[model samples]
Target: MKQKELQIGNLTLRRPIFQGGMGVGVSLGGLAGAVAAAGGAGAISAAQIGFREPDFDTNTVEANLRAMGKELQKARGRAEGGVVGFNIMVAMQHYADYVKQAVKLGADFIVSGAGLPVDLPEYAAGSNVKLAPIVSTEKSAGVILKYWARKFERVPDFLVIEGPKAGGHLGFTGEQLTSFDEAAYGEEVKRIIAKVREYEARFQKKIPVVLGGGISGMEKAARAFALGADAIQAATRFVTTEECDADPRYKQAYLDAREEDILLIKSPVGLPGRAIRNVFADRVMSGERIAPERCRGCIKGCRPTEIPYCITEALIRAVKGDRENGLLFCGADAWKAERIETVQQVVDDLLG
Candidate 1:
């Protein structure tokens, strides 16, 4: 089967693949730019993106906003004007600011998830920058599309459906993830596409649906396309790529991982996450409370003193190569990575 181009609003990608955004330096300007240059859409994560900034420790918001601009510029520099955007999570504090900043930076699009981004259109008002919300189920898709239409009189330019096998903060509950059925989820994907079509008909526009989660290679990508997905998003596959912003050790973790090494873990932000089993994860699973020495003020409504651990710190460590202590968030297919490759190579292999 020949691969088709992915059109999100006015932007056209040569490949129907999106490099899923990974936070805390995992997928930064380098990786995003490479993917975009490879003819796929590239997404830079906005989760504490300024951890490397000089003032990040003291002035969190300002530093992050500054870094966001710099990262976008870097991605654009490497992208050669390819489709580059930011993946800003709604669960983070100052979500509106991030959206506005990305728009002001001339981002091609913005993909918001980790929560229903009901206020996304409002935040991105008066801009041509495409807006998309990530949903994990048909019900969530319905709620978002309905609410957006009733309130904003608009629908998303595209929709990203992240399934249970996705890494990091998943949208499913532990029970749901445990009881997940692929066939049922495939049906759900069809229903979500139907929901999008309803909005498309009402608004007289096209809305592309992107399927993500457990998309390891060509087989998985074919399955997603067969399920009516206009595009497929894969983060784990990108992690092992040479262009990935993560440290070499981070990539090694994925290569060395076995099927049983990846497990579902609880995050401090009231969400279940998937990650490679490590000492830090094991400790958390053993009921050990790893308190945050100082707060990064990343998550919304998160009280540092009450949370089990600081996600920002853990992820930063992971990206920097401290495998023993870092939270190595990864998809179920993380174990399938055998070697590091280039962004173009991975994109070609998956889309072919």
Candidate 2:
């Protein structure tokens, strides 16, 4: 079968492949720009993006906005005018500010998740940047669509249906994730796609539907495409790429991981996330939850006193090359990656 372009709102993606947005400093200018330059949509993850700056925790909103603009500009330069977007989590501390900043900075699109982005259209109004919501089920999709339609009189430019198999902070419960039934979820995807198509007709616009979470390799991509997905977003595979913004040691963790080592753990943010079972994870499993000396208050519902450890600190440690103490997030197939690969090679392999 021939590949098809993904048309999201007014934007056209030559390849139906999106670089899944990794948080913190993982998917930033370098990786996102490279993906875009290679003819795929590059999604810059804006979750804790300011972490790279020395005084990020104390930086003013204006300063943070300025930094975001610079990063987007740098990515655009490397993309050579290809499509570049920002993935902003709705659950972030300053969601509205980040959304406004990305739009003001000329982001081509804003793909938001971690919570229902009911007011996404409001923030994106009067901007050329397209808006997409990352949903995990038909119920979530319906809720956002209904809310947007009734309250904001808007519909998303596109939709990303993230399955339970996806890495990082997932949308499913820990037990649900372990016993997830793809047969049931596959039906849910069809229903959500149909729902979006209903709005497509009502609004006289085509709203592309993309699938994320656990999508890896050519076969998986093809399967998703066959299942009616307009595009597939891959994140874990990209982590091991040369263009990935993560530290070498971080990538090495994925390359060296085993199947059993990839397990679900509780995140301080009150969500069950998938990560490699390393020393840090072991500690969490061992019931030795220690609070960080300093609290950034990143997540909305984080309970420092009750939580085992600070997610920010552990993730930062991993990004900075502390493999033992750092939290290593990965997809189930992370162990499949045996060596470091270039971005182009990874893309081509998926496209093939």
Candidate 3:
């Protein structure tokens, strides 16, 4: 039989798959809970999840805090005692606050990225929540593991290797993304896995490594497993699922996209991101300045005046059915979505 279980610490995931957290109201309670109940590790994105709350414009931080609890409660209710996690970006303002809150709410895992989550263990200290960091290169993997081992005397429960083809803010540079080579990245993943082993030896524990980015189907997943991955993480594949929280229009964007429609653009948060070719992306590429009316203050270093457009607004629009004006972030293979399926269907198709 194929190895179909992912073990970390005392937890065993029957599906050996992670529903990569897609945000801006994309993967929330419905999709996450559905995937978890289907025997996979379901994840929710904690980025501006409160934008739907009425007071988000006025009390942004408070709105988000409330939403964190609200969504987790909903997910827990729907999960049917299955495992559920959150994807909280390290670039968000009050980053550690979200981590601490998620743990308090009984979130089983917290997957962090968009920056080196060096101090994640600080916030998750004394909690039952497992911590994992997203890294795309061996250097980053080594730095993060070495830092955690020395400072907290802890290692990641698992590692998420996000390759270049993933959506939203990526971990690679523009130069690196354009010249992306699959074989080279496979080698990089192996190197990153080696770094994880070094820390695993130091801590005397098993640290599973998961491969992410453009892995949309079984073929790619099998390749990762062959390369020694304990499991795989995927976000774009879930976007078109019926249980996904994003508006139907957002899901349509994935169904309507072409392979050539995927483009790399700079996020105001100071990183390169992958998105579909739409009016919003075109405007950004054409240097049309879409100024922000007010700062919701999401990311830490984002200066309202410095960025061309308000990322929060664009994403908010994306999730609320404003397709033409919103940023549709997706993996390079998003065009492969034929129709919206159930969350269970997606998990079954990927891992069955």
Q: Which candidate is the best by lDDT?
A: 1
- Number of clashes in model 2? 1
Q: Give the root-mean-square deviation of each candidate in angstroms.
A: 0.8, 1.5, 1.0
lDDT of 1 by residue, 1-352 (tens): 5687877767999988888999999888999999999999999999999999999999999999999999989999997869999999999999899999999999999999999999999999999999999999889999999999999999999999999999999999999999999999999999999999989999999999999999998998999999999999999999998899999999999999999999999889789999999999999999899988799889997888988899999999999999989999999889999999999999989998
- Model 3 residue 263 lDDT score: 92
Clashes of 1: 0
On TM-score, the leading prediction is: 1
RMSD of 3: 1.0
Tens-digit lDDT track for model 3 on 1-352?
Answer: 2456777776778788898988798988888888888888889899999998999999998899899888887888887778898999999999988999899988989999999999999999999899999999999998999899889988999889999988899999999999999999999988999888888887899999989888888788888888888888889999998889999988998899988998998898769999999999999999898999899999999989889899999999999999989988899889899998988887777776
The candidates, ranked best first by lDDT, are: 1, 3, 2
Candidate 3 worst ten-residue window by lDDT: 1-10
- Global lDDT of each candidate: 0.93, 0.84, 0.89
